[model samples]
Structures are given as structure tokens and as C-alpha cells.
Target: MTATSSPPAAASRLDHLGLLYRDAEEYAERCAAFLADGLAAGDPALVAVPGANGDLIRDRLGTGRAEVRFADMAVAGRNPGRIIPGVLLAFAAAHPGRRVRIIGEPIWPGRTGLEYPACAMHEALINVALARHDAIVLCPYDAARLPSDMVEDAWRTHPVMLDGAGRRASPAYGDPVATAADFDVPLPLPPAGAARLVFEGFPDLPGVRAFVAGWADAAGLPSVRRPDVLLAVNELATNTADYTGGPGTLLLWREDAVMVCQIDDQGHLDDPLAGRVPPADSVGRGRGVLVVNELADLVRIHRRPGGTSIRLHFDLGIPPPS
Candidate 1:
């Protein structure tokens, strides 16, 4: 990859670059070099990637590892919707006036089709969220292993692309908002065996939780993650009661490795950035959806003219088919 030019150090904007690496060696070398350059310049550097990849980068960094912060992307970015508020921006906020450098690989070869949309949307939204911050986020994609369409999507989401040929401006870069909406297509209907419940208003929240907890238990969801599933669904139900002013429907089912909890209501979410952005204040309102995003393994939303449907996925620790 070429030593690409970044925005001026004084500029208050994010330099979002997509790194298309062919193998693990290239991925580590490129990422470690980027972090090393930032450390040389006294910038706060962070590496958030899967454990095995982190190890590779750490090895490449060697003694320099001490200067770079590390986070397990598998845990922190399990829900792509949470990466913005919980990982990227949170790290930026911790350092007030300094320009931050981050290597965020939210999408990996292991990412499933069920989780790809959320991952794609998160990458696109990074442009919007860090537009005015003096930060550089380098996202790496495994071009050899990932789907060709996903590799194609890297161009749409990032303004800069780096690979064997070197860095270049992405003429295919599209509007961030439009890219997000393109993935908001309607979800498939729940299968016949899926369990469901209809809720009226706030008064029925307790029952909603019980219904979810019971179904999740029956589906053999790990006991440790049961509360997370319950809390996420309860938040969605509460939002329906508080905002929709109409009854809502809840669907529960198990699809191989994921337990799905979907909520449908007569609510319109015009803000594509909702739940993705942190609330204004710590003690203020509007944290329900944010909390849901932080807890679920994956989240998908389908908003229509008259209503919105939000589906949260909880991984059941089952390995995907090879």
C-alpha cells in the first residue's frame, strides 16, 4: 500500500481509509506501520481487530506495542451498530484535543451474511460520525476471502482505498446516507414456527420480557446472555409503547446459530443515525436504543412508509457452516 496522503493535521475531519489486504502478513504489516507512524507523531493510536489478527499486528509492532491500545473487535464490535458510539468515538472522546488514529476492522472473513448489512452500514456511517474530528480510521478487508460484492462495497463506503496497487481516491464513493438506506430493504417474513406476542403499551412490558426470556430459555440460549436478550427486547417494546402510540408485535425464533427477536410497530424512524449516535448527556433521555445496540450481537432495521421493524440477533455460540 502507498503512503497515502491524509487530511491536514489541523483539519477537523476524519480520514477514513479502506485497506484491502490479500493475506494476514500484509494486513499486519500495513496496520502496524500505520500505528507506528501515528506513535512517532505523538498521536493516540488504537487497534481494534479480532484476537488472532491483533496478535499478528502486535508481533509486527514488537516493542512499539506498549504505545498502542488494543481492543477485541469480536467482543466490542459484536454489534456493528455499537462500534460507533461504543468503540470508535468513545476512544476519540477519551482524548480531547489530540488527533486519534484507529485501525478498526469491524468486517472480517468470518462475518456472516446475517451480520454483513449492519457491518456495512457501520462502515458507511463512520464517515458521517467523524466528519469533523481530527481522526484517521483505517479499516482492513480480506480481499482474498471476503465476497467480491463486499470488496466492491469497500469502495462505496470509503473515500480512500489502499491495496497492492497503492492508495487512490474512490470514484465509486457514494453518499453515506444513501449507502445506509440501500441496505434497509425489507426483511423476510417470520417462519410459521416462530413464537410471537402482541403488546399494547407500557403496561405490557413485563409480560414482553417474560415472553422473551421464556422463549430464549426454551431455545437453549446461553444463560449468561439471557439478560442481554431480555433487556434489548424490553427496550424496543418500551420505545414502541412510548413513541408509536399503537400496538406492537414481537417475533421470536431460532435460526441455527442465532436467536432472533424482532419487533414491529407503527413507528417511523427518519433518522438513519438513530441509536448509532451517543446521546447528548449521560443522565439525559434516548439511551434505550443505544443500550439495545450495545447488547445485541447484530441488529437489522426495516423502515417502511407506515411502520418500522427492528430485528436483533443473539448468537448462540454455534459455528457457522464452512
Candidate 2:
């Protein structure tokens, strides 16, 4: 399958080191130029959000991109209906007859915290667009910030979003875990039909939560149980990043009456997230890990080069593996 190609032949223009500064016209002209280049090179057209370093590119091609870049421009809020439809409509209209060739902007620059949903919107939009065009969607985002459902959906559906550097949010920022998380251990072999959702290069937290929530919902888990998995995965995956210096791959599946999730990164751990449970803390210390261990019937750990894999098996219906 195209998704499984080893040593992909094409050099990804998605790296988009093309971040530049200029007026909208200049940006549109540059964008048009990129589109022309893509057209000549048989590449996808680049879609620019208001501020995604797309200034020069968009100025070169597009007459003028819209300012309604994201649904939620505020740094502390949640709103999707505000921005997604417009972008989707733009996509639908732009490629009316041609293939949906697009270079996506999952995050808008000069913005606060709207890139995440925007990324998800781009993801869903691209999936639909692909049905009509030979699409290549490249979205770089903070995996942790993704909406829980979208994250899960991305894992099951969209192609992998890779690790790339963005701003490390302020330490005072709403971080779910801490420095300790960058070192959790990886666990045993995962059940079949599970794969990886790498999160270390994450610039957003909402998306990751979304992925976790989605995973829980799909795995037949209740709402309360969902947070437990979400927190655990966050802590563990963060630990993976601290140790490996990159996002870890997540493997999810079902073993009997349980939904199993294993995280693999370039770290090693002797003491896993299970065993002796810790007491409730005043500030919620070790709670996430403890909850994860408590919820699952089987919590296994494994170690690999530069990383570790921790697997949490949540009950669903089938009996434990004999």
C-alpha cells in the first residue's frame, strides 16, 4: 500500500521550511508561484491560512486569503463551527474540477491556540478531498493537543503526523504532566491490528486528549475510564520523548475482553507505571499513572533502544488471553 512504502521516493515539500514574511499580495503571489511550481512538478497546491508562514507563497498565487483563519482564535477556549466550514468550503471550491492537490496549514501563525482544531479540520477535510483528488496532506502539530476523537480517528484513519519542532509552551502553560513523564517504560508485544500515534513533537495538547478520548470511546470504555487512559498515555508518551528525544509510536488493539494500548519510545524503565499504587495527592501527583495501572487488568512493560513501551489492557468483554 502507498501508506506502507519503505523509503518513500518523494522528498517531502511538507517540511515547508518556506516560512516567510510579506504583505498579503506578496504572499498570494508567492503562493501562486508555489502552485505554479507544483503544477509544473506534478505536486499538490499549497493552501495558506492567514498566518502560517504562508505569506509569501499565498501572496504569489491567491488574490487574498481570508482572515477567518481558525474557529477559535483565543488562547483559552473551544469552538469549531467558527472556522472549519469556511476552510472546507474553500477547499471544495478551489479544486472544483482538478485533483485535490494541497499543501495544508494545520496551524495558523500570529494566533493563540487555534492551530489544533484547525489541524483536525484539515485532516478531515483532506480525507474527503482525497476521494476527489490525489491528495497529499502534510500537517505538523502538537499531538497532545489534538481533540480526543480526532486523535483516535487520525490513528485509525489519517496518515501518521510526524515530529517537528514548534514553540515549547510556557512552563506555566496547562501541562497535564511534568518532566518525570519523559521517561516512562514501554511494555510487551501489542495485539494484532494496532499501530503507532507518535507524540513528542506535539505543539498542542488538545489534539492528544482528543485522540485518547476517541481511543477510549472506540475501545468500549466509559467516560470516567477515558481520563485515566488519556492521562496515562500523556505521561508515558511524554516520558518517551524525554528519553528518546522524539515522539513515541503508540500501538493499540484488543486482547480478549480488553482494549490494549502500548507506547514505544527510545527509553528504558525498570519500575513501570504499575505495581504498588500511590496515594491521592493534594495536587494530583502520580494519579494518572496510578489510575492507568488500576483500570487495566494487565499492565506490562518492555524496553527498547533509546526508549520503552508500556501497555495498558482495558477490559471490554472477551476474557484474558489464556
- Residue lDDT tens for model 1, 171-287: 999888889778787887889999989999889999999898788666777888888988899888998988877899999988878888899999887777778777578656667
What is the C-alpha lDDT profile of model 2 across 118-166, one tens digit per residue? Answer: 2333343333323333444443332344344433434332334332232
Q: Candidate 1: where are CA atoms >4 Å away?
A: 1-12, 318-322
TM-score of every candidate: 0.91, 0.34
Which candidate wins on TM-score? Answer: 1
**Best prediction by lDDT:** 1
Worst 10 residues of 2 by lDDT: 172-181
Q: Show the colliding residue pairs in model 1.
A: none
Shift of residue 85 alpha carbon in model 2, Å: 50
How much does candidate 1 score in TM-score? 0.91
